[model samples]
Target: MIPTNLVVHQQSKVLELTYENGSTYCLPFELLRVLSPSAEVQGHGPGQETLQTGKRDVLITSLEPVGHYALKPTFSDGHDSGLFTWDYLYKLCENQEQLWLTHLEKLAAAGLDRDAPMTKQGHSCGSH
Candidate 1:
């Protein structure tokens, strides 16, 4: 299903996507950043997932179209690696609520906050 409209609610940091199939999805800025399909996040091969950190207050600065099937999101942190494909964005939107809840749960389990202090190297420490 092709998205008919993609709206970014800057105040709420949510992306509202409406598809031609009558489905509407709302995804958070943080979720999209962490779950980016870019090689930087997903890595170059399997078993190489890189956990993103310090993205609690991150926001989407811009959303640019990549040809006809994807969006190139420019994040506030200058990250533009993820090319959010229509299908992938739809999936994230569809699973937004659950995914966010799970993310929160994982954060809680690890005793981490989104705004937690960064280490000296400017990166967050691994999950405890």
Candidate 2:
């Protein structure tokens, strides 16, 4: 179920994945960024998931391979921890519509705008 081709369409802001079966999925950069599997986003346990907002314009600045099993994408917002595995990517392709709907619902429930800028969190100091 591994993709045979991966094309980054900067103009369209999507990552198009083509599999051997000829099925293709065009995943939006914003979706990838918001739904990233990084601990910063997903958190360390259940009920700790962070709702991502203001990511409608996010981009994939770079994509690097992680061995033969996954991909690591550096996002325009400086988030690069998510590791997208082949199986996980395939699932994303299959469930994108539902996932997007859910994201939108969460945003609405939280009274957040998808196009608004994300407020900086944590310390005021620049030190990480």
Candidate 3:
């Protein structure tokens, strides 16, 4: 379903999408940034996907349409390569919970945090 409306809630740091199917999805800015479909994040092939960390405070700077198919979101971190198509947005909405849990699990296993990276001494090095 195509989104009928979109709102960027800066205060809440979420991008809300209202679809024609009456489904409203509120995706966090950080989630969108980390899960970006950009080659920088997804890489060029399978198993080359990069795990994103220290993105808890990241925010969307802007969003522009790419034809009628997708949105290109500019992030504060200077990443703007992702093309979030309607189908991909819907998929993210449907799998948000599971995906978020999976991300958290991966972060934990890697000794990382959403807000910062772990150092060799087990302390937060910084947001990277």
Candidate 4:
């Protein structure tokens, strides 16, 4: 199904999308970054998922359509591997609030912070 409406609010860094099926989704830039579908994040196969850190401030710099069904989202941090398909994007949008809460919970449980700094040694330096 095609998206009937796609509104990108640059100021708020939110993408509000509405599908032809009457489903609406609101996706935040930061959420898209942390949940990127790239192999770097999702891994090459099952059970290799990598949780992203220090992405709380990540922002969407641009959004380009890859085709009728997906978008290549450019991030301010120079990450652009994820090709967000319409269906997948819709799911993210729909689950935005709950997913964000879950992300925060996971971070806390792991003794990590989304905005933590990375040291020169390539390790995150902050309260965990």
lDDT winner: 2
Q: Quantify all predictions' global Cα lDDT against the true fold.
A: 0.79, 0.88, 0.83, 0.77
User: Alpha carbon lDDT of residue 79, candidate 2?
Assistant: 89
List TM-score per model, in order.
0.79, 0.91, 0.87, 0.79
lDDT of 1: 0.79
lDDT of 1 by residue, 38-127 (tens): 877776688565556688778899899999989999999878979998888877877778877876776677677766644333223342
Q: Write the per-residue lDDT of candidate 3 for residues 1-128, one digit (tens) a residue.
A: 67899999988999999987788999998888888998777876886666788777778898999998999999987888799998998888889988899888877887777778523322132423
| Model 2 lDDT, residue 38, Cα | 80
Backbone clashes in each candidate structure, one number apiece? 0, 0, 0, 1
Error of 2 at 33 (Å): 0.4
* Per-residue lDDT of model 2, residues 1-128, tens digit only: 79999999989999999999999999999999988988777777786677888788788999999999999999988889899999988989999999999989988988988887777655323435
Which residue runs of candidate 2 sit more than 4 Å off their true CA positions?
122-127
> Which ranges of candidate 4 are over 4 A from the true structure?
21-23, 118-128
Candidate 1, superposed: residue stretches over 4 Å from native: 101-112, 117-128
- Of the two candidates 1 and 4, the one with more favorable lDDT, higher being better, is 1
Lowest lDDT 10-residue stretch of candidate 1 = 119-128
- lDDT for model 3, on a 0 to 1 scale? 0.83
User: What TM value does model 4 have?
Assistant: 0.79
Q: For model 3, what is the error of residue 102's alpha carbon versus the real structure, in angstroms, after optimal superposition? A: 1.1
- Weakest 10 consecutive residues, lDDT, candidate 2? 119-128
- When sorted by TM-score, best at the front, the candidate numbers are 2, 3, 4, 1
